[model samples]
Target: MTDHRYVCSSCGKTHEGLPTDWGFKLPDEVFDLSYLDKYRRTRSNTDLCSLDESRFFIRGLLSIPFTHREGEFAWGVWAEVSKATHDFYLENYSNEMAQGTKASGVLANTIPGFPEITGQALDIAFQNSKSRPFFSFPRSAEHELAADQRDGIGHNRHHQFLELCGHFDESEA
Candidate 1:
């Protein structure tokens, strides 16, 4: 069996186990077959996978896939939210979409139902530009404001994005 160990921060306790009851819904013929074949060989033995492969999986989410650049290139904004928030957003997303109106300027931060999705923005990324995309390590980095991250109205859209997601506090973003 795999020998990976995890420690809980709350109880200061350690435990050994594999992630259980995990399910991901993805499209058929999505993943790279070669990568899947290699992973299958070690599936029962370990949790190890190449970072480049992991980045490949993440970049697949991009609307426009450009392979001209090397390394990980994340495009667009994203946030990690709680399961409750995710479900709520999914259920009411259509309503929000229907209610959403076009902003006066190019990039408007406010969307009718975006806050519901972002309310529990446990982490966020400020990848507002195709160039200079944010590369998140194991966890989210500090909320340092960047040019593309800032909207036209003096508010950081990334910060606004966090607020819409539901964190009313400025520091939270």
Candidate 2:
């Protein structure tokens, strides 16, 4: 796909390419805490996060295909995992054997324009040492996000997401 150019609504600057990936800097639960509480109860880096010394989370990519395009859009989102799964991930960090490892978790972000999906069941699969794990819904999941993932989304719907996230070409709008 060609690069998408858009004038950012938030910054009021002309951004050259449309971003295919969007992410949250922190999990919603931690993000909602007060400044002091967040720092006192959380320890996080780019890929892993721990809250209250008990809750564990890992960053992952959730990709949805474009119905009429050659590529997919991705969300760099976080997942809440069991302590055992989180420990296993840390133990296998940067190890090739970690590839294909699967774990059950819950989506940790409320994606824009979608109903509250923060606690939705999610399945994660590790790609390799170099890439973040990929997130998916269980086969039995019944939600709009799951349907979009399974059936693909139209270009217009994708554009709506871009706009919702403050990335939109005014000319097209």
CA-lDDT, candidates in order: 0.27, 0.85
| Model 1 ranges with Cα > 4 A deviation | 1-75, 97-148, 151-173
lDDT of 2 by residue, 3-56 (tens): 777654446786775656678888899889999998899999888999999999
RMSD of 2: 3.9
Write down the lDDT that model 2 would get: 0.85
| Per-model RMSD to reference | 19.4, 3.9
lDDT of 2 at 146: 90
lDDT by residue (1-173, candidate 1, tens digit) is 43644443335676653211111122112223466664553221111112222211111111211232322212233232334433333344345342322111011111223323211212222232232122222223122222222212222443343344343342224
Look at candidate 1 and tell me the lDDT of residue 102.
Answer: 15
Locate the minimum summed-lDDT window of 10 residues in model 1: 101-110
